[model samples]
Target: MGKVTGFMEFERLKEASEAPESRVKHYKEFVVTLTDSEAKIQGARCMDCGIPFCNNGCPVNNIIPDFNDLVYRQDWQNALETLHSTNNFPEFTGRICPAPCEAACTLGINEDPVGIKSIEHAIIDKGWANGWVVPKPAAQKTGKKVAVVGSGPAGLAAAQQLARVGHDVTVFEKNDRIGGLLRYGIPDFKMEKTHIDRRVEQMQAEGVTFKAGVFVGEKLVEGGITNLAKESISPKELMAQFDAVVLTGGSEVPRDLPVPGRQLKGVHFAMDFLPLQNRVNAGDKLKDQILATKKNVLVIGGGDTGSDCVGTSNRHGAKQVVQIELMPQPPEHENKPLVWPYWPMKMRTSSSHEEGVERDWAVTTKEFIDDGKGNVRAAKCAKVEWVKDEATGQMKMQEVAGSEFEIPADLVLFAMGFTNPAKSILDAFGVEKDNRGNAKATTDGEGCYRTNVDKVFAAGDMRRGQSLVVWAIREGRQAAREVDQYLMGATVLPR
Candidate 1:
């Protein structure tokens, strides 16, 4: 807890970013940080509530009140340790997480919550500057092996936890870099890759081995499985080689639109377009890169993925940008009395939305129009409305008659989110899938985080369906505890 009367005396404050006009010119991170003193006042705003819901709100269960109190007491080092005790990668989450912890703060029920995110950012930065963050290698090796497939937050968290517990951990990634989606999907303007680089260094020093460009599933190439270098390990081989395997590979298969002209040259998946631009920004040479420069860009889907597309398009100097959503828009502000202390259903404007873009809701795509030579030129869409049944209390989406309209579109990016993890790898391992097509695993009931296969585990989007990075990190840490307990009969890793 923080100062007893601090909540009434101080107001919440957070870091500000550079102007959108300036930030759009390059891919560099533009968010400014709060000075040490400014961060202290923000931290002091935390009320000494008997029960702190912010901890539960945080997927990784970060000790929010303790850090807030430490910062208030001017003890930055203790704050950093308390922050890191639960979250393995505060730097990553501090930048990208939506900060639901703040929303759930006890003070937030009546007033603004303590600036937990900004304080977290400050503490970690201070820790790095003061050389407080260092690799803590295990005193002795456990001799057990853990093979973590994927290098995203989940895999990285699990690997770090297991490695710190003295297990031999190897992280596999298909991409050339170690941080899977973190290195590719997220734009550098949000979080600089240097944060990930240092974490990789720390993990390596802690005895965790990271092998990039190693796809961990059976795939055919020019010759055959023989031509497949050991770089590509089969699921069966992984099961045999490692004492335990954790599938942290994200739900990567994008939800597709099969309307006519979807195969047009200008139409592409958000992952395809977004990752290529990120690669180019990181000094990678590409044969032909995806560009929105001077093009009319249309982004389908109205989630964070769509927001990211808008931001990227503005950076590309798009002539015009349009973001379309299928659902009808909610109220600008939610009914707080009805949905207090919970994530409310309301419209959210992202930093990407602050950049130039036209946002529309209740819009349905009918077809993608094309030029003679297979290039997408426009899209036909219709308006929709929600109709509720009186007897059944069921709601159904209905299209407005004769409301079809055409919108210009040189490029279209599908960001409708993922339906499930890729089926091939899960199938190879004979992992059971839920009705939602995500890997089936129990949580907290019995045998939590355990896949049907023996000595195998699953977490992140692969296990729980597409979710926030915070949720993935939470699962990764929890999965590590389960794996540890299975191997050693108990574990100290926090759940």
Candidate 2:
């Protein structure tokens, strides 16, 4: 609305990226930030639509148009304020979140959508550089202690919010670092770890205590899916010590391919491989590290996790990288009229894919060939066709006859996504689980966020299953509000 005719005058301008060849040499963020002028022009492209669907499209419901207008008018301070009002870590979302808000933009129906994510990146980066981002400690302490399990985006957001509202907050992390998945799951090439480190410093200044390397409840069910915890705390001790406990632990049970030769040594879950590389990048020494150097790497499951594997493998100088998807390929472009204002099912290519990866769709792995030394040598795969059944109108996949093939792959990483939270922790706490195995908890009304046990709550992937970082932040913020209300009989914290 800052410039009424700006949408018609300006085209979407994406942030510049480092060349693939040059970027793959090291693990660091390579996205070139937009200059102030470019960001202002991009922000000016926001139109005055009667309804701002981009707001609702964003998982955190970011005030897109307001921030855009602020940026367009050179009100950078207010823009940062508006961004931080809803999002505790816009820098993280700006770096890694797939902008669903842009897909739902009003202008995207006929033209390129506003570069909202770029503008957000500029705003937050500027905020940090200008010392505009600082800790907000409560003036009065509530004397109520809150424990947040898991220090990922959700747990961090909840801890920050509760701490700001005068409650004593302690974050428990299994890993040595504060960030759970952000510190390990995401490669530094996508987002450097310094962003999380700075936030941790700010939170600490706000009276939030971080207990890293301390595992709450029992051990993780799936070994190698996470960094092993050196210290352990029982659920009974946590419940008895803290006034309230919020389980923001993410879903960590990775889906496995139970085909022949799954026991091969070279076949590993993406989590097991990814975390090790991150540790090495963080200057930790590992006796054994999963290396893709000079090996033909096969990444199963075409998703963000798979793309990440492609990038990390390239960084490790893999001989070749091939990514496979079980489902049929989606249309490169979606029919906007049919899927406007909602996330469309269209083919998405990440920067990692651009770094050089042979991608295939509608293919399924049949077996992992062994090298006779308990190691995977190659993967046997087959092409599949999806057809709609006339009786039920449901599509099913069938392998094509004579389409079986084998590809050389000394290393295989399973990035097929997670099924649910680790079962052992939930069982140790005696928390009820939904049919999907996620922690069973309501999101509204009485007993919101309250688990079966008194003073216990669940949020993020622990309650809703595997999801985006933005969704995790939203869940954590809302759960913090509920916890506050439950303890104080009222809360000023926003939901």
Pick the TM-score winner.
2
Which 10 consecutive positions of candidate 1 have the poorest summed lDDT? Answer: 220-229
Q: RMSD in angstroms, candidate 2?
A: 1.3
Computed on alpha carbons, the lDDT of every model, listed in order, comes to 0.88, 0.94
Candidate closest to the true structure, highest lDDT: 2
Task: Put down candidate 1 lDDT per residue, 1-495, tens digits, no spaces.
Answer: 546888899888858888988999988988777788888898879887888889888888899999988998889889988999999999888889989888788887778778899889888988998999999999999899999988999999999999999999999887778787888888888888999999999999999999987777776223221111246789989989999999998888889999988888999888888877777877888888889999999999999888889999999999999999999898997776777567778889988899889999999998999788789999999999988988889988889999999999999999999898878778888999999888899879657899999988999999998898899898999999999999999888888
**Model 2 per-residue lDDT at 84:** 94
Q: lDDT tens string, model 2, 298-410?
A: 99999999999999999999999999999999999999989998999999989999999999999999999999989999999999999999999999999999999998999
Model 2 alpha-carbon miss at residue 26, Å: 0.6
Error of 1 at 95 (Å): 0.3
lDDT of 2 at 197: 97
